[model samples]
Target: MTSFQMPNSADQINLREWLDEQSRQLGFDGLRITDTHLGDASERLNQWLAEGRHGQMEYMARHAQLRSDPGLLVPGTVRVICVTMNYLSPVIDFDQEWQRLAEPTHAVVSMYARGRDYHKVMRNRLQEFALLIEKQIGSFGYRVFTDSAPLMEVELARKAGLGWRGKHTLLLNRESGSTFFLGEILVDVPLPIDQEEESHCGTCQSCIDICPTQAITAPYQLDARRCISYLTIENPDAIPVEFRRAIGNRVYGCDDCQLICPWNKFAQRTALPDFAERHGLGRASLLQLWSWTEDEFEKRHEGSAIRRIGYQRWRRNLAVAMGNALADEAVSEVDKDELREVLRNALPTSDEMVVEHIEWALDS
Candidate 1:
C-alpha cells in the first residue's frame, strides 16, 4: 500500500487529494466528487418505475425521492464521492467464459457473484475510507453506500466521471470497462467535483444485440423484467416460460451484455482477493450445483452473494438452466435423459415454485 503524506501546511493538503490517495491505497480504481443534484436521472427513474420496468423489485419504487437526490438520502449532503472498483477476476478469460456459457451442462454464475458479497466488501472499504477522511479533516457528516441503499450508484458515478453509463446502463470506462462495482459516500463537505465523461458507446450495439432475452430494449434503455439477472436474482416469481430457453445455463445472474461489450476487453482485474472465484463457481457444472442439499447450499454460499437468493431460488434457477440444457441440440440425448430424470426425482420433494420450474425444465 502506498502512503500519502499530508503537506506540512494543513491548508495546502486538500481533502479531495488526501481522499484520492487513501482510496488508491484502499484498492479503489477510480474516485470522483459530484454534487447532490441527480438532474434528469431522477425523471428517467420515475418513468422506468412507472412503466414497471423495475419488475418485482418493489423497493426501487418505495425510495424514489431518496434515490434521486443525495441531499434527501443523506441530509445536508453537498457532495457525493463516487468510487469504482474493478472486479473482473484475473482467473477468467472472456472467451473461455462465453464457451462455458455455451455448454448445456455447465452452470454460469455471473462473474461478480463468484466470490464474496460485494455489498459487504464495498461497504466495509467505503466506511474505512470515510473514517480516514474524518481523521484528516476532523469530524464530518457522511454516509457510505454500496448497493445496500436506495441510491442511484451508476448515475452518481457517471456524474462524478468515474465512468460514463454504457448503452447497457452500466458504468463503463476506457480502462476498466463495465466489469466493476460502484459505491458512494455522500458528504456534507463541498469538494472539487470531476467533469462528467463523454459517452463512448458510439454506434456499437453489441450489448443490446447479444442479450439472450433482449433485455436491453434500446440503446441506453433496459427492461429489467426481461433481464436474466432480474429473472434469476430479484424476481421472486416463477421463471417466465418465454425466457426459459434464453436463460440457458446461467444459474445465477447474467453477464452477456458486459461480456459482449468491446470496452470489456480493457477491463482491469480486481486487486482484492475478495473478488476471486470461490466454491469453483466460475467452472461449476449445472448438475454439480443442482445436487447441493439446502444445508450444503447454505454452508457453501455463506459469504457469497448467490446465497442471498436462498436455496429455493438457487434450485429454481438451476432447474431452468437444466431445462434449457435439455432442449439444446448441443447436449446429447443421453445427457438430456439424465437431466430429465434428475428433474423428475426432485419433483417429489421440491417446493411448489421449484417443482413447477423443474417440471418446466423436464418438459422443455
Candidate 2:
C-alpha cells in the first residue's frame, strides 16, 4: 500500500499506503510501520538504566516502565511509524576534517549541528505526518516526537526495519549508514508492523576502534559518560578534566565513531535544504568565531541546534579551541597575542563557567 494518496474508492484509507506515500513525498530516506509494544527493548532499557550508563539523563530514569511502554506515554498507541532521514553529504574527508578538529586552531562543531537545528526541522515534519493521518482517519490520538521524547526511539526504529542497531548503539542502514535522524509518530490506529532489520555489524569493530575517547567500551555498549556528545551537550557541569583535552575543538558533539564507520560510505544527504551547512560553521576559523559577540552568535545561529548550548558554552568551547590554537607552533605571535587579548577581555565580564575556560585557554 502506498503511503501517499490512498485510493479514492476506499472509505477508510489504508495507513500502510498513506505512510509510504507521505514518507516518499517528505524526502525521508526510509520509513517503516511498527508496533508500540517494544517488548525486549523495555527490558534492556531497564537493565541499561540499572547499570547507570545513562549518566545524568535522569529523564531516562523518570520514565520508568513508561520508557518501554508506549501505552503509558500515549494511550492506545497501537502503531509506531518510525522514520529516518540521511543528513550526510559525500566528499567530506573523514580523517582530514577530524584532524582539523584535533588542531587547537580550529573549532569543531558536530557534523549534525553544523547545519540547522534538526529538532525544529523534524518536529514540523512529524506534525505534518500527524496532520495527514488526522485528515485521512479522522481525529485519532497521536503524538509526534524526535529525540525529545522518552519513547526509546531507537527501539521503535529498529522494530520498524529502518535500520539495525550498530555496535556503536546507533541505527545503521545500508541506504544511509548511520548519518541520519530518527523520529516517530505514536498513533492509536493499528498498522501492519515491519520486520526488524537484522544486525550486520559482524566482526567489524570499526566504530569501536575509531572512537577518539574510547567511549564504546564494547561492540554493542556505549558508556555515555565517556561520550563526547553527551559530555558537550547533555552534561552542563564542568567537563571531567580527563576528557577535556581529548575533546579538543569539539565544542558541540562528537562523530568520530560514525565518521570512521565503513558503512558511512552509503550515508545519504537530506533532500530538505534545512540540513545544509550554515555560514562560519562547517569550515569557519577558530579566531573568526572567537570574535563573535554574544549578539552575533545569537543572531547567526538562530534556529540552529547550536543555539541550545547558549552563548557561554559557545565561548567556553571557543576558549578550549583557542587554547588548542595557542599550542600550535605555526600561529604567528601577533595572531596569538590578539587571540589572548580576546580571551582576556571575555574573562572579567564572562560567566564563571566561561571564565574557567578562558583561564584554561590562557594556560594552554
Candidate that would win on TM-score: 1
Per-residue C-alpha lDDT of model 2 across residues 73-127, encoded as one tens digit per residue: 8877778888887776443557777687666667777888877888888888889
Q: Candidate 1: list runs displaced more than 4 Å.
A: 1-14
Estimate TM-scores for all models.
0.95, 0.91
* Residue 132 of model 2, lDDT score: 80
- Per-residue lDDT of model 1, residues 214-254, tens digit only: 99999889999999999999989798899988898998999
The CA lDDT at 255 in model 1 is: 93
RMSD of 1: 3.4
**Residue pairs with clashing backbones, model 1:** none
lDDT of 2 at 178: 90
